[model samples]
Target: MKKYTLLLVLFFALTNAFAQVKTQYFDENWKPVIQEDMVYYRPEPKAVNGKYLFKDYYKSGKLQFEGFSLSKTEEKFDGEVKYFAENGKISGTSEFRNGVLDGSVKTYFEDGRLRQDATVKNGEEESAVLYTYKGTDINGSLSLYDLMTFFDHDERVKQIIYDGDPKGIRQESYLSEGKAKYYGPDGKLLGELIFDLYGNPNNGTMIEFDFNPMKVSATRVFVDGKEQQLEKI
Candidate 1:
C-alpha cells in the first residue's frame, strides 16, 4: 500500500507540471501560440505591474540593439545604443531621448579613429562640425588647410593695409552720395578724390610726398589742372 501511494503521488505531480507547461504555451485567447504575443515565446516581454517595459540583456547574451518604451507612449526613451565592428571595436553610439536624437552622436572609423561627431536636437541637425581624411566645401573643392571660414550670404568687407602692417591701416570715407571722398593712412590724410559711377577719378586733389627722406617733396592737386604746392620740409 505504501508503494502504490507513492506512485500515485508522483504521477499526479508529473501531470500537474505538464499541465502548467501546456498552459504557458497558449496566448491570452487560449489559442496555440506561434508568434510573439505567446507566453512561451523566446525573448519574452519584460513587464512591470502588468505594463510592458524595456528589454535588458545578460552578459552572456549578444545584444546588437536595445532601447525602451514608456507607458502609454510609443516613443523609446533613454538607452545606451551601440554598434560593434566586425573585428570587435565600438563603431558608433547614438544617444536618444523620447525617440528623438537630443544629444551627441559619434562614429568611428574601421581603424579606430574618431571620424565624426555632431550635436542633434529633437531629430534636427542644430550645428555640425565634421572632420575627414579628404573633405570638400560647397563648391566641391578640397583644401589642405586645417580650418576654413566662409561667408556665403554677406558682401565681403575689405580693408587696405599700408607697408604690409595692419596697424598702419587706411580708412575709406564716403560722401553724402555714398561716394568715397577722403582716404587716410594711419590717421593722416593721404589723398582726397571723388569718383564717378565706374570709380574713375573726377575733379579732385591729391597730395603726394616722401616720408623716409622727411621732405614735402611733391604736391600735385587736380582741381581743373595739376597745381603744385610749395612747402618747407
Candidate 2:
C-alpha cells in the first residue's frame, strides 16, 4: 500500500509537469487569468506585461495552433498558424497581423505537392486558387463556343464565329482596322491582309488568291453584311 501511494504521487507529478495549458487569456479588467477544471481565474501574473497568448498542442506535444490577444479588446493577432501531417511535415500555413489575414496561405497534399493557394484581405477571401496536372500547359485553339465575356443577362459578349475559329478566316470583324481582309478556298474569311495606307498589301497579309471563275464570290459591305456596296469583279 505504501509503494502504491508513492507510485500514484509520482504519476501525478509527471502528469502535472506535462499537461500543457489548452487555453489562456485575461479577464475583462485586464487581469492575468488561468483556466483549469473548465473555469478561469485571475492567477498571479507570470511572463510579460498582461499580454495574453494561447497555445494548443497535438497529443504528441507538436503545436497545433497558437495566437495572441490584448486584454480589453475582442481581437486576436495570430502571428503564424501551421498545420502538420502526422509524419510531422508542415501541411499548411496561415499568417495574420493585428487580427487581419495579410499574408500568403498555402496548403500541401500528403505527397507534399502544393494543393491550393489563397489570398486573404482583412479576413475575407479575396482570391482562392487551385492547380491541377502539374508540368503541362493548356492546349487547343480558342473557338466560338467559349465565352469571351459577359455583358448582362441577355446580351453576351461572345466570340463571333467566322469559319469556326475565333480569329475567323479573314481574322476581321466589326472592329476598324487599316488592312484589307482575305478569304480562303472555302470562301470563308481567313485573316486580315494588312495593306499600307497607300493601299499596298503588307508582307504579313500576303496570301494566294485563286482566280477561278467557277468559284462563288461574295461582296464586302457595311451594316452587318446586309447591304452589298461592292462586289468581286
Candidate 3:
C-alpha cells in the first residue's frame, strides 16, 4: 500500500514539472504586457500548448495587433484578428481560419477613416469596396468578376487590380507595362491588351494580341508612338 502511494506522488511530481517546462518555453516566445489593467500576450514564431490570445505592441506600449492562435501541430492563427495604428486607432480587421484569411476584412486610414472593406475566402479575395481618404466612394462594390472586366482597353486601369485596388484575384495572370493579360479563375480566356511604344493603349502600335485561350498570335508592325493606323493583315 505504501509503495502504491509513493508511485502516485511521483507521477504527480513529474506532471507538475513537465507543465512548468512548457510554461517556461511558451513564455520565452510570448511577451506579456499589461495596459489599462488588461493583460495581452505576444508571440514570435514559437510553440504553445493550447488556444492563446496573441497580441502585438508598438514602441510606446500601445496595442498594435491582437488575435487568437491554436498551438497544435503548429501555431495557427484562428478566429477574428484586429490591427491598431500607433495612435491607438483601428487599422485593419479580418477573420482567419487556421491561419488562412476567410471572412470580411476592413481597414481604416490613420485619421480614423474607412479605407477598404473586402471579403476573403480560402485566402483569396472575393469582393471589395474602396473609398478615398476623404470618404469618397472611389470604386463601388466590386467583385473579382467585376474587376476582370473593368478595363479591357486600359491596362493602366486594370493594373489597379494587381495592386489590390479593391478585390485581389489570384488569377493565373500578370501585369506588363500597365497591361494585365491572363486567364480567368475558371481557366477560360478572360481577355488581353495592346500597348503602344510609350506603353499606352493605342491601335497605332500593335505588338501582340490574344487570339484564343492561352494562345498569342503575333502579327503587327508600328514604331515610336507615331500615329499610323496599320492595315488589318
Candidate 4:
C-alpha cells in the first residue's frame, strides 16, 4: 500500500517518542495477521498517562477507525470509536461500555448531515431514532418492534440452535405453543411471546427496556397476530 510507505517515513520521525510501536496487522476478521494478509493495521506507539491508543487504518492509507479497544486482541471495544469514510469523513461513532453498546450511536451522510441518531443503553435501543427515511425525518414514526426489525434486531432473538444449549446461549424461542418468556443476560425478564401451534407469534407484547434503570423503553402490541402500534414510555 502506498500509505505503508508514507507511514514508514512518519514512523521514523516519531521513533524517539515511542518506546516501541509495533505495527500489528489484522485480516478482515481482526485476527492477528502478517503484512501480506492485512486489511487493517495499528501501531499503538505508546500510552500516555493511562490510556492506550487504538487507531486502525486501511491498507490504502485512508483512515479507517480511531477507537479504544480494551486489549490488544481488539475484542472488547469499551469506549467511543469513530469510523471514517474512504474520503476521510467521519462516517459514524459508537459508544460502548465494556463491549456492550451503552450510549449514543450515530451515523452521518456524506455531506455531513445527521443520518441516524439512536440511543442504546446496555445494548438495547430506547425510544425512536430520529432519521431521514427516504429524505424525511421519521421521528416517532415507527413502533419499537418496527424499528427493531428495521435495524435487524430480530437476529438477536433467542432460538433453539442446539440440543441442551444453556439458557444464555439460545438464539430464538422454538416453543410451538403457548407463551415463552425471554430473559436478559442479567437474568431479568426481557419480554414474552405467545406462539401458536404453527410457531408464529399469535398474540402478545414484545418489550424493550433501559437496563441501568431497569425501565421499559418501548412496547409493541400484537393482537391475533396483527401488529398494533408503538407505545413509547
lDDT of each: 0.47, 0.48, 0.53, 0.63
lDDT of 1 by residue, 1-233 (tens): 99999999999999988644221233544455664455322243344553434432222333323445444234365544566554566777777776678787778878776656666778875554344432325367753222211111232222222222323423233433323333334456656656566654554654433433222344445553334453433
Better of 1 and 4 by lDDT: 4
All candidates: TM-score:
0.34, 0.35, 0.40, 0.45
For residues 1-233, write the lDDT of model 4, one tens digit per residue.
89999999898879866744578998989898899999988876345444455778998878888876566544467788899987899999999988789898998878776667777889998633333322233564432221111232323332222112234311235333356555554545556778777766678776655532234567777789887877888
Candidates by lDDT, descending order:
4, 3, 2, 1
Best by TM-score: 4
Model 1 alpha-carbon drift over 4 Å, by segment: 1-63, 69-75, 134-233
Query: Which one wins on lDDT?
Result: 4
Of the two candidates 2 and 3, the one with more favorable lDDT, higher being better, is 3
Instruction: Give the residue spans of candidate 4 off by over 4 A.
Output: 1-21, 29-31, 70-75, 128-130, 133-233
Q: How accurate is candidate 2 locally (lDDT)?
A: 0.48
On lDDT, the stronger of 2 and 4 is 4
- Per-residue lDDT of 14-51 in model 2, one digit per residue for the tens? 99877534334444443555442222222222233555
Candidate 3: worst-modelled 10 consecutive residues by lDDT: 21-30
